[model samples]
Target: MQIVTRLIAMTRARKLQRQFQLIERSIVALPVRTRSRLAIMTLREVGQASKCEFPHLYGTAPEQRYMPWGQGTEIGFSRAQSDNAEVALRGIALWLAVAYHETKESPYTSLQPQHRQLLRVLRELRDAGAERDAMAQWMRSGAAA
Candidate 1:
């Protein structure tokens, strides 16, 4: 039985390796510009997805509070309050996507300082509050233009 189980695991591993190889080949088959475009689109989508708030955090109370024990500062954020933090993170993600496509031939290349700064800002916003207003502001500005 043990030998049979080992053989099954080995077979599964081989299948996974083949699947990975196919995916790698598919990515490599695309032209550089096409790949860059895909990266840009993917980044945009991911940024949007990140903005989706966990609805469980929702409540109709005028001032709802939840304490995240580790942080020690009782987080007292409403949907309106967190809007900016979300916007900031999404904006940074969008810029990072642009940087990935425009700056280097490969996405694996070292990030520029500006891109790093954007990442830092995103992290700061994430830590500051959950409303993620920054992400909302970015989306609003884009729509306005």
Candidate 2:
């Protein structure tokens, strides 16, 4: 029974390795080391990166767990915030478009330092497949147009 348990543990580790490799490849197009980051993040990291505290961070450090998702798993984002996050993301996308295309247009011709930072964050998010659907929503909303 001990041997069998050891074998099972080894198999799970192998599966996690493969899943992480696939995740890395999917984010290879990103220009930074975000490709190498694990999909799961700590509550503090999430809150700091997002600049908004999540309700679950109730003074406890959640154990970091590697959750290997299956093929059928679907990704999504929080919606309809009063803070107008979606509009802000869309504006960032629009400014990034102007910069990317080098249209030489005014207004969005030059972005603030933070705008550039957020743009990179968006790229990282999209490449990591965390917000592909949200990216699509921005593209379809014509808010970036």
Candidate 3:
């Protein structure tokens, strides 16, 4: 049964990888200016959602795609926080990287690089913690604790 489940997951992963390739190709064909504007718009949208639940567009990497607006807003908020904002900014950067390739804008007009870097760091920390938590839960559940 476990083997069957693993095989199914592998199939899904392959499908997702193909989809990612297509998304990459589309992004590469976009105009630079449009890309920039898209980033700005995406960030603006993210900022607007700062107070909501699941503010950073959280998702498991293998099964989830980040939303541009949500990522940008998270970065903006991290910037606003003024300290240890890397995680939020990183989320924004990742989304921007994907979005910029598909739009016309320059991809940092609204949010500066320093802030973006901070956001990136914060995201790493957040992801690490989540991973640790997940592993711990799995271990405990399996009587391996």
Best by lDDT: 3
Off by over 4 Å in 2: 33-145
**How high is each candidate's TM-score?**
0.25, 0.27, 0.30
Cα lDDT of candidate 1 equals 0.36
Across 1-145, the per-residue lDDT of candidate 1 in tens digits comes to 8677556545533432343344334434545444444345435544543443422122213244241111101121111123464433333333333332222232222323333543453343343333334455777896757
Q: How many clashing pairs in candidate 2? A: 0
Candidate 1 regions with alpha-carbon error over 4 angstroms: 37-145
Against the unseen true structure, what C-alpha lDDT does each candidate score?
0.36, 0.33, 0.40
Best-to-worst lDDT order: 3, 1, 2
Q: What would the C-alpha RMSD of candidate 3 be, to one decimal place?
A: 19.1
lDDT of 3 by residue, 1-145 (tens): 8677556545533433443344334334435443343345445544543433434442213233444332332333333334343343344434433332222232333223333443453354345545666676888895784
Output the lDDT of residue 15, model 1: 39
Which structure is stronger by lDDT: 2 or 3? 3
lDDT of 3 at 51: 35
TM value for model 1? 0.25
TM-score of 3: 0.30
Under the 3 Å rule for N, CA and C atoms, how many clashes does model 3 have? 27
